[model samples]
Target: MADPFGMTELTEILRTSIGLDADVRFDGELAETEFAELGYDSLAMIELASQVQRRYGVRITDEAVLDQMRSPREAVDFVNSLLAGKVA
Candidate 1:
């Protein structure tokens, strides 16, 4: 399967989901910035995860996995891995 969400796309989703400033950088920040630093509470994460499932068709049903996704880059990587597994 093709990569449904590129880093840019994933970053955009995260930015929108977390209500970040449009000018905020994401490339390096995405990997380093924790979700809490971006003002994402547990409710926000649940919403984000739901949006991810809806938009990417990747089910993130595990709370542990969601807890592990501390940054946008991690979320993007996890989603890509799930997509790759489907293709394989």
Candidate 2:
């Protein structure tokens, strides 16, 4: 199995999903920050899910990204669950 999904990877995908420049650092705490506050809406979440699927070979549904996942930390944890086959 691949290594666990993490913030660094998500950071890149998140920035790209929102069309932010790669060099743009996220202001405030990343784990605590909501995706909406960071400029990601439903569409962006779907895009993030797509990128993650392509890159991670993991299938995270748009519904999971939109409804289950919230902050970056939640995303990481949710992804890890899927990766570990422990999602409930």
Candidate 3:
């Protein structure tokens, strides 16, 4: 079976980048943001973003975007859109 989220390649990139073990389907809601609650901190976010850029071959140069990516789900959606040639 194909991974549902993996349909968007960047979602797979996010999983690899963030070491996410669980499936994440992001709808981009701020109320659902929970990365820190899930044990991701600044260091983890930075590492994840770096890996995302490297894997996706896109430069995520906006620091504000890092602050806004507050959960594994959110990060997956954001990166997925970016890779799809869309804005998150």
lDDT of 1 at 70: 68
- The local distance difference test score of model 2 is 0.76
lDDT of each: 0.73, 0.76, 0.60
lDDT by residue (tens digit), candidate 3, 1-88: 3422333553465466655557655445632667688666777777767766766676665584566567655665666667667323
Question: Model 1: clashing residue pairs?
Answer: none
Error of 3 at 3 (Å): 8.9
Give lDDT tens digits, candidate 2, residues 20-58: 655755434867677788777888888888888888778
- Candidate 2 residue runs with Cα over 4 Å from true position: 1-3, 21-28, 86-88
lDDT accuracy of residue 1 in candidate 1:
58
TM-score of each: 0.78, 0.76, 0.57
Q: Which candidate has the highest lDDT of all? A: 2
- Tell me the lDDT of model 3 at 72: 52
- Superposed on all Cα atoms, the candidates' RMSDs to the truth, in angstroms, are 2.4, 3.5, 5.6
Which regions in candidate 1 have their CA more than 4 angstroms from the true location? 1-3, 15-18, 62-65
Query: How many Å off is the CA of 81 in candidate 1?
Result: 0.8
For candidate 2, list the clashing residue pairs, or say none.
none
